[model samples]
Each structure stands twice: as C-alpha cells, then as structure tokens.
Target: MLADFDDACGKIGLQLNLTKTMFMRNGWVPDAPFSLNGTNISECSSHVYVGREVNMMNDLAPELGRRKRAAWGAYKSIEDVVKKTKNIRLRAHLFNTMVLPALTYASETWTLRKQDENAVIVIERSIERVMLGMTRLTQVRAGIRSSTLRQQSKIRDAAVYAKSSKIRWAGHVMRLNDHRWTRAVSDWTPRNVKRTTGRPSIRWSDFFTKSFKERCDALRVSRTDRTHWTTLARERDKWKNCWRPLGLPDDQRESRSRSRSSWALVPPRKQEAGVNLSFGVQSSNKRSFLHFLSNIKTVSVESIFETAFTV
Candidate 1:
C-alpha cells in the first residue's frame, strides 16, 4: 500500500513531508503568547513567557510572494492565447467522463458508417457560419479580430462529433436488445432463420451509418423548411398570389411562421448543384459552395455537401 501510494503520488508530482517540527510538538500553541521571568525568583513560581506568537508568519511572506509572482507570470503568459480562444463548448467535450465514452462508442459503431460525409459537411458549414458571425461581431465588439472564431468552431464540431458518436452507439444497443422493434421489421432479419426467445441480434452494417443519415436528414429538412419560410416572408406579395392557389392563406403566412416573442431569421442554406432550364449553366441558384467553404477550415469535397443528388 505504501509503495502504491508513493507511485500514484509520483505520477502527479505530489510531495511528502515527515520532518519533526515545532508545530507537531505538544504545548506549541501557534497563536498564543509566551512569558519568561528569572528562574531563581522562586522554585515554585510558574513563569509567564513573552515572545513572537508565530515566527513562521513573518518568515513565509517572501515564499508566498514568490509563489504569487510565479502564478501571475504563468497566467499572463497565456493571456494572449486565452484571448484568441473561441469555442467554450469544445473544452467540455474533450474532457474524460462516462458520457463522453458512450458517445465515442455510438459514433464508431453507428453514426460514422452511414453519415460520416454529412457529419463532416455539417461541421464545416457550422464552422463557417460561426466564423462569419464572429468576424462581424468581433469587429464591432472589440474593434479588432481579437479571437480566431474558425478555430473555436473546429473545437465545437469535434465536441458535437463526440456526443453524436456516443448517441449512435447507445442507440445501436437499444435497437438490438428490443425484441418487438427488431421483429417488427422482417426484412431486417435474415431469411431461412427461426427466432428463439432472447436470441442475440447482429447489425450487418456499422450502427452509425443509419443514425448519421437520420441526423443529417433531419438537419437538412430543418434548413429547407427555414428556407421556405424566408422565401415566403420576403416575397409576401408574390406569395399572396402564387401560394393562394396551393391553399396557403395569403394573410396568415408570415404570422403563422413567427410568434410575438420569437422572430424567425433564416440562416444561409448550402446548395446542391443540378441542371436548371432557366440558365444555360449547371449551377446552384442558392449560396455558392466555394464562397461558404472559404469561411471554414478545410476545402475537401467530402467535407462539403455540394455533391450531385439523384432521384
């Protein structure tokens, strides 16, 4: 036990003290005064002693001052680095904990297999959005680019990936264990097989693939819905006439999408390229991929969602 204790302490550079000291001795009252008189006055006399209550207090100021100075110097050295920091969320995600490990399992077992490309795309786009907003906000708030927002977004993306990964893993376990859920989908089960009670189930593909696709599709749908809201709100006059034929109320379209306390401001949507009859070129009519890519970190095609979509 002693050896193990010392070894553990050594790993974190902890110190041990076993020296005999005045404080450890009996009758060493730390804050009390002492008095002394001539020993010859009386053999039965109890002498009152007077001296410094605590000499260590006087002696330790210099040591304390040195420690304070060292700490301040160390803190100031990282002042510039801290000032340039952005994502607060990423820091929490990188820390080791039970929740983080679960997320890791989920990402590896499920989310990674199917929607790895989409995850990369979402992360890249999210970074660009944050950076663009931060750049403008920083210019106004601090009168300079005091922090690199792109760097922070990467941290946030990494954290999100960790969390999403774990969710995918957990979901895989839940799906396998649920008897009714698995049995409901016969196609998912193999042919020429008979089921026994409490039989173990195996997922053929990576668990993350389906989970990743679901998450990506949901995000895409949300973006599309918001885009439609923006179009309707902006072109209210055109919407009144055009959308009325499709049974959408002209007067309630704007109010239906918003509330008194909440106003819906649309974010820029990523565009996929397809041939347009109105234009001679095969180009995206919405946001340009390169323009958005420049704001984020990497420019890999796999990281961007501008791939050709087929029906």
Candidate 2:
C-alpha cells in the first residue's frame, strides 16, 4: 500500500514525507516490516492526527489527561478573575465558555466508559470546589448545604456533555447521504474478520446507541425526522437536567426507609390458596422486596414467580 501510494504521489509530482509519517494497526496484529521509498516506516501504538490522539487499543486515558492539564492551565489563566468575581454566575459562565471547551475538545469522538465519566466528574467537582472556595475537608464539615448555595447548583457533568455532543454529531451524520465518507464509515463492518481474544474494545457508536436510548426514548419515532432529532439534540438544558446527580436529601432518605418498612408490613393481597407465591416467601425474609416491587411496573404473579425462581 505504501509503495502504491508512493508511486501515485510520484506520478502527481508529490513526495511522501517518511520522516513525518506513521503507520498504525487497528487491532492486535503484530507489526510487519514496511518501507516507503527505501525508508522504513515506524509503527506506533498511537499517533496524534488532526489534534486528536488515535490509539491502537482505543485508550483515551492519555488524551483525557492531556485535556485535563490544558483545562487546568486555562482555569489558572482566569483564576484571579474567578476569585475576585462577586457574581457566582459570572464565574460559572467564564469556566463554561473558556475552560470547558479546552477540556472537552474533540470529546465527540471519544468512546467513554464509566471510569472516564468518573475522572471527568472528579475534575469538574474540583473546579466547582475552587469556585466555591471550599476544599474537600471544608465541604465535609459544612454538611447539608442549602440548594441556593453555589456548590449545590447542578453544573452539567463533562461526560454528559461529551455524550450529548456525540449524539448531536451522530444525528448530523445520519442526515447525510449514503455517499458521505463519515456515514459510510459509521456503518462499515469488516467481512470474515475475527476479533482478537478477550474483551472487545468499546466503539463510539456503542456509546451513541446506549446514550440515545437513555436520553432520547423517542429516537425510533423521530430519527427519520431531521427537525425532531435536531430539536432533541439542541435541548442542552434538558440533557443537563437529566444528568444531574441522584443524591437525596437526609429527610427524604429517612422518609424513604420508613415508607419501605411500613410497606413491608402490609398484608399481601389475597391470592388462591396452595398457589405458590414468590413474594410471599421473599416478604417473610426480605424487607426490601416490597420496595423493589414498588419501583417495577405491574407484572403477572406467574411471571414474577418464574423470574424469582429462575434467579
């Protein structure tokens, strides 16, 4: 392939820069010897192309760390302004507009996992703590701050923002005709190629599919409608709200526990005698059984029995 490329370039009066070029393998394939114009082309585990690092194993830790460092630098540049600003909103605005873009540059292309999300959240929470002038120690001591507090304000999680950006990009790509390279590559699958052993690497499209289902339940009905999909993607506030932390207040937690206990004590609804009941057995031992049932949609008694016994 390199020889053919070199030949084609020569025909067009162009030269291949072997010094600047790198070859990378997509999967767990051993490196093969290759040369371009008698110069050996080095194989690399990863390479930075168009500003984003493309890794053979699809690991984003290095890239994410780089972004975090860049973001910290950006924040440091405006740290004085952030500290002196009387308005919390102004500080937040500055962080969002100036620092976040640096942190999340090219995030749309990332295949994020739970660990990646947690890492981004840690950085974000650190920034938020800085803005509020509270360290981890102080925050723990403060305990149960009011909702109006600056720290309590629900800032959009960086991982959620990245996922949303990818969804928006996906919608754009889906709108493109079949002839587009982006569209074609998105749907392409290698023929008769077996994956390397062990766990398969996560793909950006897999994240898209999962996130779309979670955030856009109406996706199937609206996907073909470009305007609808666009509207869904543009609802940044809605997406942000959806991604808010699930922590509950102390009072709510206490009430929930009490309610669960009370529900557990309630007599079971009458059922045919001698008909084996899964809940009847579970309720005798597990106080949390009723709590779980409350959250689930109504199911047939027989199906519930089958499920419990199968488990």
Candidate 3:
C-alpha cells in the first residue's frame, strides 16, 4: 500500500516529504526500517498531531499531563482577574470559556478510566478552591463539601462535564453512517491477539452495557436504578443464545447474516436487497441525518395518555 501510494503521488506530480513523514510502530517492529521510494522514513516515539499527543506506548498519562499543563497555564494567566474581580459572573465565564476548555480539550475522545476521572475532578476542585480563597487546610478545617464549593463558585464540575461530553459523543458515534470509519473502528477487534493475564482495558461502549455496575462500585455508591443494573447483569447470561464464534453453526439460516452490519441508528421497516435489514438503515432521500442529533426520545404526557387509552 505504501509503494502504491508513492506511485500514485508520483503520477500526480507530488513527492513524499521524507524528513517530515514519520511512522509510529505500536509494538515489536522489525529491524528493517520502513521506507518510501528507497528513502527511509523516520520513526518516532511520540508526536503531537493537531495539538493532541500520540504516543507509541498507548499510555494515556502523557496526554493527561499535557492537558494538566495547558489547564494550569490558562488558569495562571487569568489568576489575577479571578483574585481581584468583583464580578462573579465574569470570573465564571473566564473559567468556563478559557480555563475549562484548555483542561477538557478533545475530552469527548478520551477513553477515561476511574483514575483519570479522579485526576480531572481533583484538578478542577483545586482550581476552584484557589479562586474561592480556600486552601487545603481551610477546605478540610471547614469540612466543606465539593458540592458546596461548586454552588459557591457557580461553575459545573469539570469531570461531570467531561463524562457528559463523552456519553454524548458515544451517542453521535452510534448514529454515524455504517460506512464511517469511526463506527467501523469502534466495533473492530484485533485478530489473533494474545490475552495478558490482567483486567481487560475499559471500552468506551461499556457506558451502555452492564459495566455501569462496576462504575457505581468504583464511585462507592449506588444509583436509584440499582435494581435495573442488577437485572441487566442477570439477563446477560440468561438471554444470550449459543452463538459462539468458535462453535459450529446450528444451521445456515440460524447464522447471523453479514451482508449488513447489525448496528443502525434506525431499524429498517421494510425489505431491501433481498435480505432482512434487521437494525440496519440504508441510504435515504428523506430528512437530513444531521438534523436529528440523537434517537433517544422522551415520552410526553400526551403520548403516555394516548398509549394508556390504546392499551
């Protein structure tokens, strides 16, 4: 593919910038250097692309550190304004628009772990405390709650904002076109990968799954929907069919059709291309896909009444 790309670029009167081009090898790359048109391309341990840092190690600490540095820098720059300002609204605006944005840059893309969330929460609270003239000693001495500090400052918690952003991004990804690379990459599992003996990496999609129980456990609290969480966990094993990938098929008809992906924003109501569409939606000349942001809908009072009467 590299050779073909080189050839195609040459035909189009363009040449590769050997010095500028660099490749990141994930793990155990070969001794032979990868090249384009006999010119060896540089390999890098890390590179900042369009602001975000990409590391060969896949460790998120560096990116989080970068965000921290940026946030602190932004905060320090406006510290005088925060300290001296009589206008509470102005201080809040600056914090939200400038300082918070720096802190949570591209946070929607972050596959955050519990530690990462805690880190963000701490940073935000620390900054808020500084603005409110509350030192660590004072915060502890007064026995002030985080909720009280947020109420005093009139600023939302940064960690909560980040989680909200991430969940919203997840929904957007769910509604993405099947052909979109974002959707494809979300579902793609690496083939022939060796399993290390430890806890599996957290998946972004786990927000929609039974893993919410684990999250609540980590938070050391239970939501109002505790029973609902338990139900999902119990039903996972109960409801699943014997559709193991390694097992022999019951019959050809029983096998899931692969002509279309099982995921969709809206399930098809009619047949298409001689196959059951299932949850797959095809191309349409109707309303704009972007016009409607998410498929999640709330039942109105009228709808509840209508359904109740119909029932």
Candidate 4:
C-alpha cells in the first residue's frame, strides 16, 4: 500500500511527509508497525483534522470544552457592549452571531450523546447568566424569575441549534453524488471483517439512521422529492420550534437538582462508618446535628466538620 501511494504521489510530483504521517486504529485491534522509507509510523488514538478532533470512541467532551472556551473569549470581547445595551433583542442577536458559531463550529460532524448534550446546555445557560449580569445565587436571592430572564434574552437552546445543524448537514450529504468519497463512505458497509465479541461501537451512519428516523419520518418521501427535503432542512424556525416537545421533564429536573445539591454535603469518614449517627440519640446537641444533616441531605464528613466549626 505504501509503495503504491509513493508511486502515485511521485507521478503527481507530490511527496508524502513521512515524519507527519501517522496511523490511527478504528476498532479494538492490536497496534502494528508500519514503515515508510525506513521510518516507523506512530500509532495514535485520535488526530486533529481540519480543526476537528477525530477519535475511535468519538468522545466530544474535550472538543466541547475547547469550543466553549473559544466562545467565551468571543463573548468577553463584546461583553461590555452587551451590558450597556438596553435592547435585549440586540444583545441576543450579537450573542447569536458572535458566540454561537464558535460553540457550534464543525458540530455537524458530531455524534452527541445525552451527556454531551447536557454539557453544551450547561455552557449555554452559564453564558446566558453572564449576559443577564446575575449569578445563580444572586438570582435566587433577588427573586428574579427564570421565565422573565429567558423571555428577555431570547436565546434559543444549544441542543436544538446543534440538532438542526446536523440534520442540515445530513441533507446536504444526501444530495451529493454516489461517486463522491464522502457519499461512498456514508453508504458503505464493511464485509469480511472479523466481528468482535461485544456490542459494536456506534458508527456515524448508525447515529444518522436513528436520528433521521425519529426526526424526519418522511425521509424516504423527501429523498424522492428534493424540494420537500430542502424545505424541511432549510426552514430554521420550524426546526427550532420542533425541539420544544423534547425538553427535559419536571421529574428529571428535580432529580438533577437533588444530585447537584448532594455535592455540597461531605461523605462519611472511614472511621465513622460503623458509628451510628442517627437522630434517636438522647443528647440534644447531637439531635440538632443529625437534624441539620438530614435537612441538608448531604452525607459528607467534611461538610459536617465545616458546619460545626462555623457554628
């Protein structure tokens, strides 16, 4: 394969940079050595291509964090202008134009799981909080309502934005000719490859299949009719509004709140594991400590010590 590549490149008057060349394994396969011009090629788990990270596991957390930081830098540059502007609509427009692209750059290629979706949402909400010039604690203390803030900001959900982008990219890819490399790969299925024992890792095509089935049930009809697919994919407001029904449920929100609050409490010490710290004790002082701990719902010994020391 290397000899063929060398010949092809030589015919084209192009030379392959052996030092920059590296191989990445896609599945659970043992690493093997490859040599080019007597130079050994290094194996890598992931590689950066066209500013996007490609990896075997397809984890987007690091990429998301990088995008978030870049977006935050963009936000900070115009933050003063945002704060001085009384027009909430203009502030939102600036944010959408300036910061959102950074956050969503190359997002069309991402195969997002629930955790990745949540991470993006958290970043969006945090930025919105900053735009509103209020911290979470201050917002709670001042009796400032969430609905009011959201109405004023007019910031759409990041997840909805990402989903729309991905769907649009898919539509674009679908329109490409079968002769194209991307189109060919998108449609190809490997044959004669030995199967691993466990469940196979989800591929991009698999993710797209599930997403398209759920979101665009009329995909087959749309494929037959280009105009219909274009209308569905190109209409931004319609697709954005489609995500309303997919919002997190009230019970899930409550559970998330409980989980977050749980972080405030310290865990029990190893030495105190066998000790009974229940409220049935006769001493009034210990009863108060137990009651406080129960009410707070935190189980950490560090928090207990901090609370006791503060008191």
TM-score of each: 0.20, 0.63, 0.62, 0.63
Model 1 ranges off by over 4 Å? 1-150, 158-178, 183-188, 192-204, 207-311
User: Which parts of model 2 have CA positions greater than 4 angstroms off?
Assistant: 1-15, 28-30, 144-154, 196-199, 211-311
Q: Cα lDDT of all candidates, in order?
A: 0.29, 0.53, 0.55, 0.56
Span of ten consecutive residues with least summed lDDT in model 2: 258-267
lDDT of 1: 0.29
Residues 70-119, model 1: lDDT tens digits: 33444344445444555444332322222223222212222122244344
Clashes in predicted model 1: 18
**Stretches > 4 Å off in candidate 4:** 1-15, 28-30, 142-147, 191-311
The order of the candidates by lDDT, greatest first, is 4, 3, 2, 1
Backbone clashes counted, model 2: 0
RMSD vs true structure, all candidates: 27.5, 18.5, 18.8, 22.4
Q: Tell how far residue 60 is off in model 4, in angstroms.
A: 1.4
The TM-score, computed over Cα atoms with residue i paired to residue i, of candidate 3 is 0.62
lDDT of 4 by residue, 210-303 (tens): 5445444433435543333334433443323232223211221232222211001111221222222111112223222322321231123334
In lDDT terms, how accurate is model 2? 0.53
| Residue 302 Cα positional deviation in candidate 4, in Å, after optimal superposition | 54
Can you write out model 2's per-residue Cα lDDT over 123-232, one digit (the tens) per residue? 86777787667787787787844233433433444654565455545555555464543454455665656666898666666753554454344334355532333344
